[model samples]
Target chain A: MTFLPPITAYTCVCAVGRGRDALRAALTGMVGGLTRFDDPVGVLDTFVGRVDGLDAVELPANLTDYDCRNNRLAELTLRQDGFEDRVRAVRDRYGAARIGVVLGTSTSGIASGEDAFLAWSGEGPLQSDFVFEHSQDLYSLSDFVRRRLALGGPSYTISAACASSTKTFIDGAQLIAAGLCDAVVVGGVDTLCETSLRGFNALQLLSPVPCRPNDADRQGISIGEAGGFALLERDEGGSGTALRMIGYGESSDAHHMSSPHPEGLGARLAMTEALEMSGLRGGQIDYVNMHGTGSHLNDRVEDRAIADVLGPAVKCSSTKGWMGHTLGAAGAVEAAIVLTALEAQIAPGNLNLKRPDPEARCRPLMETVPAELRHAMTNNFGFGGNNCCLVFSRDDAR
Target chain B: MRLRVAGISVIGSGMVDWGQAQRILRGAESWDADALTVPTPTILSANERRRVSKLVRLALGAAEAACDSAGLARGAMDCVFTSALGDGAVTQAVMSALRQPGRAVSPTHFHNSVHNAMAGYWSIGSQNHQASTSLAGGQGSFGAALLKAALSLSQSGRPVLLVAADHPFQPPLSGTRPTDGAFAVGAVLTPDVEGAAGPLLDIEGGVNGPASETDTKALHGLWQTCPAARAIPLLEALLNPKTVVLEAGTGYFLSATVSP
Candidate 1:
């Protein structure tokens, strides 16, 4: 595997807050962002990590056709943490055509589709104003981002369920390695949609209350909406203290679509491959950001996979309790949290974990603790048995 | 990037398989404008077979054909699945259910509604633990998947499978997001050219270019209506040995130089 470039700039927006400072506070303070479900469209009795002020958002006049809840969320996130200005600076250095855009999203602007469907009287042509290309298409997020940022390089959107955004790092690095771009904006955005809300409810995976990951009494997941992004560029002899992506691994379980493999075979393979690629032993990993969705099968299988690969000593936690399971955006959102923890030299404990499952072998942290962190790993497993593991390291620590 | 096309397959309304597609493109067989009949994927178990949607069957059918053409094990290569609008039928079904008094979305439909549902089913049927990525580049999905597969092959020095498919949306959705037909195309790409069954292709270019026109008019304008139909010109060039540049969408172009 090729050595990935450092993350030059990164930012995120969720129910907790916007920008890194807000995320840092949420992590260190152990505060959550979930709220009770009260939307008129949502009929389920559950909690959601809904971002505020989307209804008032307005896209630029030139991009009016691209208006949607998901794009609004993307627009909101891009403006936070000076992300847009930072991207502009890189665009000046690398040129607009030299920087690529790769975003991950599951639902895209499907909420707009739902609205259009709702407004239909079961008659003639359903609202002519509904633009499927600019809204509901899976590539809409990337398209809007690319145009919003005025980038002319190669762009695409990954939609591998929850593992969507994590895989963007791998693809972005490959794009640079293949000489397609000098830098790639990689991240994900998924907005609250009725389809996702009612769909998870149908599947019996939605927890009525806030998600309690790895808890003995944990129910399921609290669906959330979030958007996160990072600018990746090749290391041109930058400062030694820069945060860099050391390695990444991806795999498929070939077992089930919605359920994880019982033995966590694919998860183990992904982590093991990431370790091998980074040239580090499993014990060298100081902390791990687990994909603890609070679902029974997910947490259990992931715990087993971590035990098999990183062993039982590594400190692990799930931040979903802070911002529900963001689905497609979970990978990048958690990635931002991992970077934050690495910078502060503090490992965040599982937000909602009370009594860890007795069957689990890996240790689940219950309280945020300061630690000497060098290398960290973040795991994201998605539906369709897709699994991705990414390793990050502070150059100074290495 | 330079890679060898180890195998190729195509399935659509009239183009049932690669061989049949070649005959039609070569003017040997008449283009049939009949409704598409998606084949059942035998690679999957009966239990899984019963759960697959029409889009899944179309995608897996093309994928299995490509693997067979290359004499490659389905479990060996990494895969990239791309589609402009994935399983729209399921999306409509779920949304229609949400409109009712009780939004009773089917568990099965909800699960299958994911963009990566086909990728998930592919892994289960193939039992391949290799990395599989599902992505969308809107109308440019084919070019994006091809470039991604080429990049994967270059990075891992291994064979990669590329599959692109899109099925027509129903009723209300069909009004705005109209797809004239359903189509899928698959190819196995390898870094090594030695003993390659298909042509060696020099793939280059990126987003933003003029779209390419298909030389074969007998197939009608299916290429203009379906995203996957854009692969027809390239598939024709694959069998006939020529240079072809295909516009993936308004924003992407895939230029391929085929060497037999």
Candidate 2:
């Protein structure tokens, strides 16, 4: 039985110029940022890798009912840049019914909701802008994307905290493998909000300095916001570039609500399953994009697991240095990074690591490393002890 | 891939409140786990029992019943549990606490707020280390859960047990409630496993049809004020040989079938 061929990936990043050009620049080290901020939530920090010149414009009066800055930013990623035209071109070739859309986000428009609450405090309910539509509605993201893109087939929103968007690829692959859809547009997007900032502040996990992933003296995680999406298909002939989701593994630890299992049991299981499903072994992995949120427990557990499973030879890095942890959008953003690395042949260096933890067994990539790309994997773990690992490889390299 | 639903069961406040515990038996005239019990025996652990919200308990208890009915150990099955408002009790607690400054949200309450809290509890209780997933799709939650469970079974050889549950929200929160009682739907499905009596019907085709009058009655039979109501229409159709289609959502186009 023939399975869906692996999809090629087209990606862009902070260092890379926007679109393919920006992505190419990111591959060559064209970017660095303001890394200092005085805020406790890490939102106003100097190193936020925010996309320059992409401002949230006031949408038309008719679309005001969908009021939310998150959704408005979402439009720039989903519709601007002629992405719809590119999608239509793919549909013209693959057929419309064959395509599906699955998106991930932890707090869809929560920032907008936070704004509304502040407005309600100042202006009475009637005076407040139409903010309620965004705050409480569970379908805020899905409803907006589906309506805006006119995507009729099986559109849904996934919210599993930071790991949400990466899991969308898992769902997308299953649908295509099951012959549900021939193609899927999958990714995640999230904007910063006061709720998230305050929530992290309350947790006492925000780093005032730029985050250092594997450093022994690393502070807490630095927060970042971004929107990233990828159009995926079973066949290679589609929009952007083709990158197949070769393998994915999902497991729940049931161990802790907010903390990872001290043993990294779920993460290890996810990595093992992903490798197994990909029909590859630990020795075959050329690079791994660690979840490296810079949290003490997270980095320690992940580092030990990487050393134990894949060994000390495999190159690893936490790009969270370049971009603050994008939370829900991290998976897609990192996925973009992985594809960019494979295509450009240079792995992005882990940004702020001054001294690698001696206890960490896995080798942390400190500078742009050039290599013959074969296979790469990205891992994400969520708040509920939910873990997902995805493995992507160069179609021709293998 | 053609996957089979090998075994399934549902337990809910509706069945428990109906006072017909025997309906769950292999051969009972009627067993409704939704009924109210006479003695109201506690189903949760002593430490957390008092604070157990109806939905969490029903989800756990119902999945246990499902394990019992399927004759499979909890540790043996891959699981998927879902809810629209996971631990509505927790949401209420958090919202109320947030209203008061300096009131710390209980760590327990915060943990249970995840939509898949039931799955997390099941994983620990059942000791099922296999893949477990949690999904929430508002009114379309059941169908979404079913789709996810079937996909899991298909992709992997493991037998999957799905528990979908929900409870009526408390006052103020009640306005958001879709069902009035707590409910849970559980199914033990194995790849290519045939039912003893017949080939379990695998549903396909129009699942999102526009709602109509005929669809309303069919949907009403499945409708209850709880998340477990999802299993009612399904179990009703399965028990009755004459039953033809199980409408999964409001749209007329989507339905699943069980047939030879």
Candidate 3:
């Protein structure tokens, strides 16, 4: 069965910019957001795509219990492009009880929890106000959104590492198809945190420089934090020109916890399933957003999968060069990037590439080029061998 | 939409196995949360076993038990695992490690930190290629996962395995969670088929929260501590010879009726 849900409205806040315009400009200009990141844990010297002005991003007084850098960043994104207002509009369109909220976050409030722990070690006990409501758990992101939107419908959070937010779209579509909710507010948010930085560093995936996807000399990934939300609804009746989600496929490697399978078997399965569900063939896709993390195995395996599925002809690029890897938020932020690229009819080039990986199957775009952008696909694979692919197309193409 | 429960398992403080837990839920046996002990998943390679956390053990253990109980190959179905509170111990370890200058993070701990780590381990152990999802639905995690699994069961021709696991956060973090026993609940639900045994349940979606009507306080506390016990309402029906109604929050209810 075809799972089609049109993204009626969407917005995002990332290191590259705040909304579609900022992201699109960065994509078109090939500007990289990587800068020398001062390791919060004081472990290593590396570059990161950290979001600016997080300190200035104020939390509403009512949400003090949920006050944390991650939630603040989520709120910052929610306040973008009138995303909250759009959600309220959705709630209004379909009574509040008919709307569901789904969010993805790898590090919801762990950053705040870390601070609280540090104080505990220095002092005696945690302050009386320290509650886990919006603190360290994964549920806080969705809880925050649900309370903010005042929606009394189904709500949840997905945390499949990098694929966390991407899978939320699939979940939302299922919720809608199952007739549980008329409209689903799907969002992804992950903010910079000590655990993430130190952990990735320990895994030796953090690049010493701004990441260069598929670049022959590319080293590793530059992590970033971002938040984005999409309003997903069943297509009732329309001119068929609006951008909407056509298909999604979720799979697991079951191979390893952290590293992906060398053969890209899981990647192939996810991409194939997505294409099958979208009712489109490899030749039908105009562009592919590779989950290029600028790492050796990641790009190599993903490229092999892309080559086998979309073939060498389809245009492919990694937007991570522009905003870094946003972890749980990568899926949603990159999905938005694909939509913006589709809108402009331009396939953004893979930035910071001095030379392409010889093992790559898909030709990496190095310069922005106008094309007949129709059906675009994006891939996001996370830890635990979790993989997800989403297909979005312009309704006008119908 | 309804599901035929082929196999079910619950692990926590009280029972030695799912069978014992089922017996207790049925009121045939005494309840003891302290009796729960998570054993090493012998299904995985020793190397893989060494790298797993307690939370992984809880999830995969229950999956194995459920599949075994249903007389189905573990990989014969897709899987969905939901946890309201992901392993607090791991989070605390990572957080403490990050607070220092050297910041020496254990390679094992870092990889085991993802919410889907158990799903990945289960896939590796079962060698299943089917899709898997890990979710957190705040306080109503089990209900949300059941709804998601129902979606999968409806879309796919194969059965879907739904696992809900919750472990109290460690230490000061554990103070609030109050759930003394870490538990994982497993249920193998297939498309309701003809001649599928005597007891069957039709999960009717669209009911909000646990019914305000009535229930034993012990069961309520079980749910409070072990989100997996949210299935207690369902187990209450399966354990008893009588058909019962299970209410899911957010106005979605799962109505399970035993076959006459």
Candidate that scores best on lDDT: 1
Name the better of 1 and 3 by TM-score. Answer: 1
lDDT of 1 by residue, B1-260 (tens): 88888888988888789888889888888888675879999989998899889899999999999999988999999999988888888999988997788778898898898999988998889988999999998777787888889889999988999999988887989998668888899999988656656678998866345756677896556787788877777787777788777654336576877888
**Lowest summed lDDT window (length 10), candidate 3 chain B:** B208-217
Top candidate on DockQ is: 1
**What residue runs in model 2 are displaced by over 4 Å at the alpha carbon?**
A1-64, A80-82, A112-137, A238-242, B11-13, B17-54, B86-89, B92-109, B170-181, B194-199, B205-208, B211-231, B241-253
lDDT (10s digit) by residue, model 2, range B1-260: 44555556555553552223234422454433346422211433565455455666777776776666667777777777767555656655654544344434455665565555666666655556666666555455666567667766777777788877776666444543344665666677767753432247475533454311212232343364444465555565555422233222222123566654
In the range A1-398, model 1's lDDT, one tens digit per residue, is: 48578887889999999899999998889899999998575567889999989888888889989999999999999998888887898788878877888999989999989999889999777788889999999999999999999997778999999999999999889988888788889999999998898889888999988999998889999999999998888654242437889888999999988899999999999999999989999999999999999999999999989988888889999889999999999989988988888899999989888888998898789988998888999999998999999999887763
Report the Cα interface RMSD of each model, rounded to 1 decimal: 1.7, 4.8, 2.1
Expressed as tens digits, the lDDT of each residue in A323-368 for candidate 2 is: 7787777898888888777777677677778899888887687777
Which docking class does model 2 fall in? acceptable
* Docking quality class, candidate 3: medium
> Model 3 TM-score?
0.95
Model 3, residue A65: C-alpha shift (Å): 1.6
Residue range with the least summed lDDT across 10 consecutive positions in model 3 chain A: A233-242
